[model samples]
Target: MSSELLHDSGLIANPASTATLSDADADSLIAELALRGRAAQRVLAGMGEQVKADALRHAAAALRAAAPRVLAENARDLDKGRANGLAPAMLDRLKLDDARLDSIASALEAVANLPDPVGQVIDQRTVPTGLELSRVRVPIGLIGIIYESRPNVTADAAALCLRSGNAVLLRGGTEAVHSNHAIHAALVAGLEQAGVPADVVQLLPTQDRAAVGGMLRAAGLIDMIVPRGGKGLVARVQADARVPVLAHLDGICHTYVHSAADPVMARSVTLNAKMRRTGICGAMETLLIDASFPEASSVVAGLIDAGCELRGDARAQAIDPRIGKASAEDWDTEYLDSILSVAVVDGPEAALAHIARHSSGHTDAIITGDAAAAERFLTEVDSAIVMVNASTQFADGGEFGLGAEIGIATGRLHARGPVALEGLTTYKWQVRGTGQARA
Candidate 1:
């Protein structure tokens, strides 16, 4: 609650504002948010599972009820995006329709239906010293979510944190600020109606970007920071944050077709993996084809026919004259668009080797009929999510049946892969002993 606490925590008070508010105002804003978030989290942690579930249900209902307003706000964001020359892929992520709005509300209900993670016993044992010890899941209080572009993250992040019993401070990108405000209003309405503190989920009032620095440096206030955005934002958060960060970096995902891959299956899966919503983080950005695989041309043909722009290596260019030349940078790029980078490799080993060099460690898949090759690919590729004979598009939290994900963590520590409600919680050791003293 005090600004002096930052200095006391051995963290320098950062220059959080030179653009919007004065340093004093920025510090005050963060201090107030911290106090409110901590207060709400304490109350939320004591609530029973049913209470939290019911509140989430109420929030879902509120979102559905406020659909007209939410849609209207989304329209404003879309208009601004178009006028501001926002990229088509980014605009798609920001836009929401009737079905999408319903999906957002449905995600809240889905998370509500999930088993509560808090208070669940992770491990229990009795020691030789006659001490009963149990490790139980508990809320990681006051989480800060700093994300970009996707308005759906507002609803999803809020739902996951609330379901896990952690108070959240949401900082969405300025592109969807109006939409975020509308959704936040609906969420708050439901929380207040259900007798939950409105502070349980708070969106920052300013989008000056300096408040993010404030949040990053709020050591004792925010327990952890979950950054969901492009490489730039995630890298900046990781580099600058004084608190712990769960980083969701760029999705430079890959889809490899093994030498034994079925041509028909490869065509279907590769097309879907790359184009099924190119704006999403799970969409495959690179295609690695084993030179021994038959019908590499058709696999590239299917994608091209589907309006995908292909940038290929020399070998891949030989298959299709329409293909563009791929640069050295293409291998490392996360093309969250209709464009796909193509490369032809000699064998399964070469394909695997290519993926190893280019993958962002997010999600990678192998399509093959040979179990040995599939198994080897599955065992070798080091990624957050790996698949055999399946599309990388399936790399989603809801698809994994965790209800909804806060983010797909590229980081290895603590929470990895699709971060759901369980990922939002940590554990504490509870020991029961009587008449035991250290000797």
Candidate 2:
């Protein structure tokens, strides 16, 4: 599409050099979005949970049926990503196959089975004066998502937002532009075929950084901005966005082995945390072991056996002489690769202290047989998601029974953990009174 067409239609301002929408265009789009969102909210609020579930099941089936066409378009994105010198990790994220498509569809079906989080009153009360008050779950109106090269996010985010009755405007990374567009098209088709508003789920239609800038400047147009990517992207969005942004920053997650940790459980959990899809944000970047623990050496050796390249401090290197000396920068790094940084601390206190100083406050885990230490870490650690015996990979919403997730929220305000259906909504006061005066 030409810049003139995009700018003239008020969907974007310039499509040539920057492909960004202007303030005027953003306002127009947002107004339309709000209308659609309100309409969806009304329709969904009155809908039975079973009917909503049926729509979701139908959408999932449609996605499976459209796999061949989707994969064909996805290959174009993968080729483009490679031609543009994108990282192998990013290219892998952009690529899609029938299996991945089926997974996405299965995820949709899972979400359909989850209890609807909308319009459910969380709490209710009646005052002595006979005034009734209730806190209910309601759609957040409109949301703007800025994400990276994951095409599954396109379907997952759309499904979660639609199920919650919120309209979303997604701006996926340029590497998966073609794939994202195709997936969004399929989702829109599914929604329309189900008699839902197509505008409830929309894409930015371009792959320009300036378009992200335009989205950031869209203050009144967008209700909230949810960014799902690296630290650099999250920092930029948080700094420049005019709207309230839900930050899903880097996952500098940690797994600390307490003195009382069972060696067998610790070894298995730590290896899985670091090696199972190291490219994912929830993957462990650092491993902390108690200096007093007798089995620390064997645990470090186990990690190495799992194909993890060990980078450690002097203390760690002394225990595992094969490890390279870890640099100062390694402590704070989220090495989304095969490398794992190992450190030896005095006890649970020291481990928690180290994590509090360097963690991204995303997900952290403690492998311990002692109930006291586990309770301490669970209470003291300020991360959004903390685990006792599970791997950090369990930070995902799907694992938490939300079916799918837009992303993992590292922020601590309105939404903290997973961006599920409830996370897509905001509560509002609904008041009804007869002709009664306050006085």
Q: Best-fitting candidate, measured by lDDT?
A: 1
lDDT by residue (1-439, candidate 2, tens digit) is: 3445655654443212344556565455445544565566566667667766777777787788788888988888788778889876677667789888999989988888888888888888877667777888887777888898898998898888777877788888777776777777777777777776676777875565766776787777678898988778999999999999988888899999988989999888998999888889899999998987888878888888888899998899998778998999998998888888999999987998999999999999999999999999999999999999889988899888888998888877888888798888888765555555677
lDDT scores of the candidates, listed in order: 0.89, 0.81
Model 2 clash pairs are: 13-21
lDDT agreement of model 2 with the native: 0.81
User: What local lDDT does model 2 show for residue 240?
Assistant: 95
How many clashes in each structure?
Answer: 0, 1
Model 1 residue 19 CA deviation (Å) reads: 6.8
Error of 1 at 171 (Å): 0.6
- State model 1's lDDT: 0.89
Compute each candidate's TM-score over C-alphas: 0.95, 0.91
Model 1 earns a TM-score of 0.95
lDDT, candidate 1, 1-439, per-residue tens: 2546444433232221124655565667787888998999899888888888888889999999999999999898899899999999999999999999999999999999999989899999999888999999999999999999888989898899999999999988888888988998899999888888999999887776767888888888899999988889988998989999999888999988888888999999999999889999999999998888889999999999999999999999999999999999999999899999999999887888888888999999998889988888889999999999888889999999998898889878998899998899999999999879877
